[model samples]
Target: MITRHLTDISSKGFKVHEISGAVDTLHNHNRRDYYKIVLVTGDMILTYGDQTIEINGTILFFANPRVPHTVVHRSKEKKGYACLFTEAFIAGRERAEILQSSPLFRTDANPVIPVNSEQAAFLGSLYREMLSVHRSDYDYRNQLLRSCVELIIHEALKIQPSPNGLQQKNAATRITHLFMELLERQFPVESTGDPLRLRTAQDFAGALSVHVNYLNRAVKGFTGKPTSVHIAERIAAEAKALLQHSNWSIADIAYGLGFEYPTYFNNYFKRVTGATPKSFRKRKV
Candidate 1:
């Protein structure tokens, strides 16, 4: 497929494009702030998460911000339309969270829907309308395009409507820095009075304003370990440093590290270090 024309997603939050030019190799993760829908005919290989999928013929595709994906063109003869939009594009919906759990955009779900000729024609016509609406001067163009986007999304799933940040070199790198900064902010475990405010992957993810899974992908992609592992290791390292360098009691250490009880801390430290905290501390003493 050949392609041309892309509406600026950065400024307006959404745009519909006619699939009229050579299908460019697309890595969806780079555009980490948006979601995408495509209805196209082509022979292509799609790299979604860690899976590689190759498809020939007509198919509809959905991509969300949480997963990293790439589409490679395998054949020249392709036709289709693609819609791109930011999450803000749908912010006005009452329960936008519904879209967050849609199987179509889930990391585990196959994002492809085989389009029969009739379905293709119908979806294609919607795309055409969207492209026009996207380029129009109508005051309600965005609203209309949003409705069209919702329509295509539902058209693909045959379902009803639902309600569904930072700067760095790239998304993963930026996310990694954010994750690390957030991870370190609760450090030193200086006092049990202020336990770690954020401890789990979910905690950090919530603090960073992203899905835990998305944060994991970015952290693991760049750091070669899951977010939880990073958090665990950081805590473990802190535990060791405290045991060796600080005069704090084991119970105090435990509480400072966010453990409610010394026994829990002992179990955790032993599991991570294969040595009980008391034993390690004695040896250090």
Candidate 2:
């Protein structure tokens, strides 16, 4: 299995990473450590192990980091900015709470969210400003980056669409809460290299000590999707992240995501994403 390279920064918090190059292949990522905000300025394909999202022009949101995924640019050339931050960067648990509570943090059913031109411009400008401040040797770089992150989220909320449809009180209280909490605790891999250990409905069901069928029923009754569907969706979300954010090869990605054979992972990924992993990564490149 392939593991992503972790970059360390001072306690003050890191700046940001903005790379301009060939569309890179995605490695499997089944862990969660950092928060990512992406703004793509060109044609690109985003792949989560079993899902593929195409972006022509706009901003996308990926809050959870526990899934394994990757990204590919369809055109030969693409431009984008990605901002990565940790919970500490948010100052304290209080501030991080805002991020977790916000609807924007919802990465399960929908990971990549589209923004209007104006909203995109605002986010892009904020990220660009952070990148600029990051490059300069300043006394308060951490403070600046922190402020920029807050600003970016603020703008995101301003443009975020309001949640629609009737709300289900029971689902909101019992099943939904448990599902989200369980889902979050299993990111960035807790035990071994096995993806199953980190991202599976069965593992969650076992932890909860409920039959997989019961768990599935609860999740389905609430979210309209089966338990396996939710798990696969989250896994796919991570796949898209590694594909876009890292440079690991497809085989490495497969291994990292816990596939005993790359071929098995490849077929599974294509089935879910509607494109071959190589072709998906190639589009990004």
Q: Summing lDDT over every window of 10 consecutive residues in candidate 2, give the lowest-scoring window.
A: 1-10
Writing each residue's lDDT as its tens digit, candidate 2 over 1-285 gives 011214543343453666466664443445556556766666767775335778786765564554445766566666667776665666455456556544334333345667877777777788889878888899988777877877776666666566544323332334444566667655643222555554567776654434566667778777788877777777676666666667877776777777778898788888888877777777675
Best by lDDT: 1
Residue 134, candidate 1: C-alpha displacement in angstroms: 1.2
Q: How accurate locally is residue 115 in candidate 2, as Cα lDDT from 0 to 100?
A: 82
**Which segments of candidate 2 are over 4 A away from where they belong?**
1-5, 9-13, 25-31, 49-51, 166-285
Q: Kindly list the per-residue Cα lDDT of model 1 for residues 98-187, writing each as its tens digit.
A: 454453344434467787898888888888898888778999988888777766766765632232233222546656765786587678
Best by the TM-score measure: 1
Q: How far is 13's C-alpha from truth in model 1 (Å)?
A: 0.4
Candidate 1's displacement at residue 21, Å, is 3.7
Backbone Cα, N, C clashes tallied per candidate: 12, 35
User: Following a full C-alpha superposition, what root-mean-square deviation does model 2 have from the true structure?
Assistant: 14.5
